[model samples]
Target: MQVDADFRPILGPQLVRLDPMRIKQLQDPLVYSSIDSLAKLSAHCLNLRAPLTTCEKLINSDNTLYLAWKFDEEQNVSRLLGFAKVGRKQLFLYDSQMQTYEGEILCLLDFYVHFSAQRQGVGKQLIDYLLAQEHAEPYQLALDNPSVTLLGFMSQKFGMSKPVWQNTNFVVFDELFQSFAAENGEKAPDGWNRPQTPRRIGAVSTDTRWLRNAVSGHQSKGNAMAAPVDADMTPQGALSNRAHQAKARKAHILSSKPLW
Candidate 1:
């Protein structure tokens, strides 16, 4: 299922459903070790901030199936927004083989927007697109973001009901959901599509504080907590991993003496 291309731009980025054809775009080793690992990290952070847990797992023991959404633009091929998905096992655990009595359970497992894209409509658009999918059950959406106000706005505007209080975050429900119209009161700004705007993301918003604090605190705390992770260098582990790899390659070339 897909929305019209015209509407896609207004949504800031188009939400492309994850399938074998499109999965490669979502698997960015730079941002995530595996798409599976990215989902787990997204879950962990959302849980830490919202303090809720639904016991969702992004990767199965066998590592067989995966699902996700990748947001992208028409003009800029290199520029991308973020991706989200649900592992098959996570769906099973959450509903016991899809026996959800309440509503259709769609878990937002992994979500990331380029820092440049935060607070833009990327997330909202993704959620909106998900809601518009074909479901055999009622519309139940679960995510652990600590966006009480935005979630509340979404609940009201998109017909989602109140979110259930979980340990780490809230799981919201909606019987009838649709793509957000610009007229919707909870519409997110199109700042993401705009370039060269100096916007302080978390300043006026409640959602920003937690992320800003988490990142700031993580950086200030230094590499001690992250040293172990630093050892296993995945393509996506470090901010400068690509550059470091390039430099190492250059150094190797310089140090090695060539024989004629």
Candidate 2:
């Protein structure tokens, strides 16, 4: 998409979708020809609200994980405007206390816009675009205290509230909220758009219930497929489950301690 002149500083010329291989290519010293600059930019984000403890873990993250950065094309080399990294992790301990959580997490492990890129909408654009991707559900993005502002921005924009994970940081309730926004429409202050054609991660089709049961190794495969919902399972049931979980988590965070 073209970045209008008014939105140029906040957004780059276009949003490029990078896969694992492409991210590695850019990270390579020889290909990018600006490893030093990229490293510096990475370091700058590393130094922001992310505590030293959390930053170290990111620097040592596994090689297989995918990373995507947003850039503004000038003349020669593109400027590093902002970035986002996504990968599947069983748990992400984003604080010193080592609080853990579950699910196949597609983390927004790192999101940073250059000082010059603040407020034009680069961060919002990058995030909104990423959420619209082919695989969008069961994702959880953890943000540090300072990055909580982005959380608020997304909450108002998406008509969802940010849920604190461990009283140290907050996470956007990806699956449910995305479902809500898709069923509804964008509510963010900047008039950002939600991605069309939402798809949950690992979904073969709209029949995710059947797909999941088959993978879980239940003894009665035939019966499981026939009754997509047992007495306990249904689409409405899943929504109710999430609502209960959210309420419990909110109480846990607010009652236990201040998430400052």
Candidate 3:
């Protein structure tokens, strides 16, 4: 993503973290425009009707976007290589053992690497940076409507082979449940199978993104991995999108799972 003006002075030649407060403090239109443009492009790449990420959502939500930059000395221009947006969200999550809980969990919102940079480890670098910052393992995180490509990435990079499907766009891995069980007693406490029954390991500041989108049609009832339905990455279903209400159009579901 190229901007008219050089951003090396503002962003430098390193990965930059952008959040509501950081963006506000900078008050730079170029930064906003560049971010918005990259989001639009990412949405387009994911075959979405609208951009999943927007300036308004970032301002209102507790999302953090990490921007990977590339500075061309000859061109004297700084361009965005990729970005990964993540945040802590309170969600009704189902674990691998069919247990349900409500808590503020870290989520991978959006990830994108430019076409020119794909397969060059840029995407991995971005995700690694996110994990390092959050001090989290890949299996312990929830994915918002992950696309097929993203699913493949997880399978290949982190061996997250099993994903516990939820009614909403979010999905969790079996290891998360194992981790929770190991941390809180030997297994999920009795009555944890019911919706929002058990408490998570701990609490954190959670964003209200799901609650805000509850009224929308995209938050359809039932398991997202079930067959004959549209794709899974509805909210932030793809590597490029996250947290926004997915389009109503029917297309392909990346993969299906049992109606748990």
Candidate 4:
């Protein structure tokens, strides 16, 4: 497959994708031994099982696009602060009527910022750049087995909390099917297009201290907890809240059902 035109080198202030030829030039040990070493370090820090792509693989792989965040150190040397890997893949999706079908999607395969670079908006910049370059919405792209930090980043930065249930490993937002169908002129399978009101799960407050602990790699004292939905309600109020609770529970079950 040919690389998408939008995957061309991007030279933003915070990140860059070097030209494919330039990347190929790194095969020379004298030129890019440090960068190659950094790539291995990045993968190890992210707990990756497979080895990261070498410069040759990066240049030869038509489907995968690699991007790196750049930081200028003293003496004008550039450091690889972080990197991301994205690729197009065929995905099975659910239609508005809950029918299963195959579609093309961009998948975020690997994303990591150096531990020191985390929380400094480097990851966000990379994601935003990919979204804009591909002319795709955040919900349209899929993530491959995201880590807790990655999920939190998506939730905090893009409001992508509730993902659609899929048989595959990829995580995509619930609205993906509706938007995909609208853009493609495809109709949902018969009996599957019934209109349903979107349900809002009651907000649960997050413990900021717990989140901080998690981010700092501390042995979490406990889970990153959310306040109980009915923690402050009186007995009478709890009784009164039963109907709403039932409705929310039902919605949650329906939403969690396998779309396949």
Candidate 5:
């Protein structure tokens, strides 16, 4: 893919894609120092121990693509605003009917925006540019341990709220399954059922243990905590009970097996 050019005008002056060959440019004190500052900023935003990607790793890895967003300042100076690191990896899903696992998919490894530059639509612009360049849609790609902020952005921007449950750490949306199945020459039967309504934010939880426990509790009682429902139960208690039951029902398909 092409690198060292501005992909989006509104975002900044430059959006460079770094590879093994061009990564050496980061060794210069001016360039590498700015990247370190951006990395520290990103780590603060995500509450991470350190930056997920370093100049050393980018210079060595072949499978990863590093896209940096930069802004040209006065006197021909430039600043690193933020960056996104994406890597292609296999995505696996369990097919209950076939009792097996399916693979071969692309995933987003890491994405971040400097805290100072956030809320300016920089992240959305970056992702849009990347998707267009790759000729891929958001639903066709999976995410690896996405932060809550990223999840909220995806839901609001791309409607990526509903995810197909899988017994793996990687999270894939429902659309990917259909796309992959079609590519593998598998077609759905006529009159196949599908969701009737659009997915809402926070409708599904990725925590398998919480889902499993909620399901078991719901089947036996009305709430995950198994609290007794009586005349003394307040409206809030009743509402909580109902919510737990709903989560259990939604998680039924995924709770059947462990995510090991």
Candidate 6:
């Protein structure tokens, strides 16, 4: 939708990554208001019962909203064409053949182009940019409760047909299920989207407190007992797996050369 004020001075003519930390630091009133309106527009276009996105929810979660902006000379302002919200989701996925598996996937949560920009390739532009940045293909993606329109779009654009059913709202296509089966018990790499158990509310994080204290020239007391994770909130063995994966990710980062 076209706004009265120009966002060109703010977002520029590029695909922008809108994350919690960036928005929190920028502190722009127009940015928040514009994004909120766009999200409502998205919900309306998709016939959702309620607005699926808001600044309040954005700041509280790990999801990223990617926006494609276009300068509308007729309106004398910059218009944001659409946005794609994505994040890592842990799910129990089921294939058509009844094979079940647990995996973490990059999920397409919500996607919509503004009514004014629909059918004008704005959606494709946003998707192309997202796929490039994520280093992912359409088949590798999971969709969260996609509308029929979106499902048709996937079929047309990426040849993605029937999806594997999920226990939750999310769904992955047959290609992903086939890939998992073909892997033959081999595990996916740490950086390639794996479930990381999030620390529970009351659980103290077993962080590198000793290292930090030592760097600050503070002497630590004798060893303190580690707090147990709340099993009620945590899946069994997930904590240990997450720890191991975290270490593996760290090692991979240190060993890999800089992409930039």
Q: Considering every candidate listed, which one attains the maximal lDDT?
A: 6
Q: What TM-score does each of the candidates earn?
A: 0.36, 0.44, 0.69, 0.57, 0.58, 0.68
lDDT of each: 0.38, 0.44, 0.70, 0.57, 0.57, 0.71
| Candidates 2 and 3 compared by TM-score, better number | 3
* Candidate 2 local distance difference test against the native: 0.44
Q: Which candidate number has the best TM-score?
A: 3
Worst 10 residues of 5 by lDDT: 207-216
- After superposition, the stretches of candidate 6 with alpha carbons farther than 4 Å from their true spots are 183-260
Q: Give one digit per residue, the lDDT tens place, for model 1 in 1-260.
A: 11112222322234555544333434444322333443444446455554121112222222112222343355323334545454222221112112111222355544554445667676566665555653422234456444565466455556556444443353534232222222332333343222212222222212111100011213123343433222324445544767777887888799895321
lDDT of 3 by residue, 1-260 (tens): 66556787787656777778876776778778888888888999889998878777898888998889877777777677888889987687655544445566789888788777789888888888888888889986788888889888888888998887788888788877666656665433443332322222323222211211122122236534322433543334553343232331222233343323
Pairs of colliding residues, candidate 4? 97-192
lDDT of 5 at 222: 35
Residue by residue across 147-220, what tens digits does model 2's lDDT show? Answer: 55656666766554635454435464544344434654433223222222122222222211111101122324
Scored against the true structure, residue 212 in model 2 reaches a CA lDDT of: 12
Those runs of model 2 whose alpha carbons end farther than 4 Å from true positions after fitting are 1-13, 24-36, 45-77, 92-102, 137-146, 167-260
lDDT of predicted model 5: 0.57
Off by over 4 Å in 3: 187-260
lDDT of 5 at 161: 85
**Runs with alpha carbons beyond 4 Å of true place in candidate 1:** 1-14, 20-77, 87-104, 136-139, 144-150, 156-161, 166-170, 174-260
> Deviation in angstroms for 203 in model 1?
48
Q: Write the per-residue lDDT of candidate 6 for residues 1-260, one digit (tens) a residue.
A: 77777777777656888787866765788878888889998888777878888777888999888998877778687787889999876665556755445556788998988877789888888888888888888887899998889889888888899776566878789887666547543444334332222222233332111100011111222212333333443564667768876987887799896423
Model 5 C-alpha lDDT per residue in residues 199-249, reported as the tens digit of each score: 111333121111000111131233345444333256786688799768877
